[model samples]
Target: MNAISSYLGSDHTRCDDFFIQAETNVSNGAWEQAEVSLAQFTEALERHFTMEEKVMFPEFEQATGSSAGPTAVMRMEHQQLRSIVALMRDALAARDAESYLGHSETLNTMMQQHNMKEESILYLMADRVLSGRQEEIISAMTSIDAPA
Candidate 1:
């Protein structure tokens, strides 16, 4: 894997780990643990999105000179993911395991598809077009603060 793929893909895996932990906690009916795990998962995912939207996507768009391509699709998918997460949060607050699990399943599917597109396509193109600026982009992404 090239630098862009290596960095963002690793972050994706990290977010996946958190997602699994949250889902497992919910499955076990451990509401408190589920809350903590879900919070962690949300923070990690939001940070990943922020990194891509704030740093990587902008650089990729500028380098490629097009804003209506893959990055736009990713942004829209991010919004959908956020909406699902909000639903999951509401379920968690209501202590509705069935609702939470249903939303979690949907989230898992959406995330898998989203990550595949980014890892297989967008990241590959980014690695090619953003060559020689890998470190700079990575550095900028790293400097971004986690969502409040």
Candidate 2:
């Protein structure tokens, strides 16, 4: 895989693992562990989404000469995930396992679908549009996970 694809793919794998851990924790009545897992999941997701939104999306838009294409769609999907995450966090804080689990399941499904499309179709489109500068764009994403 090229640089952009590699970074996105790796992030997706990490997100998937955290989501699975969250599922296990919730299923086994380990609310505390699940809470921590959710925090980690949320942080990682924010970083990943920030990277796409701030750096990669702009680069892709510049390359493609379109502002309201694939990246715009992904941005909307991110907003959907963000709302669900906020609701899930509130539910978890209230010590409501039923609501939390329901929201978590929905979040996992939404995120999985989003990541798949981002990796397979959107990133592929970026790869073609970025010409040979995918590495620089990937490098620009490094700030995403930096300490804030």
**Residues 87-145 of candidate 1: C-alpha lDDT, one tens digit per residue:** 99999999999999999999999999999999999999999999999988988988988
Q: Worst lDDT window (10 residues) for model 1?
A: 1-10
The TM-score between candidate 1 and the true structure equals 0.98
For candidate 2, the clash count comes to 0
lDDT of 2 at 133: 92
The C-alpha TM-scores of every prediction are 0.98, 0.92
Which window of 10 residues has the lowest lDDT sum in candidate 2? Answer: 139-148
Using lDDT as the measure, the top candidate is 1
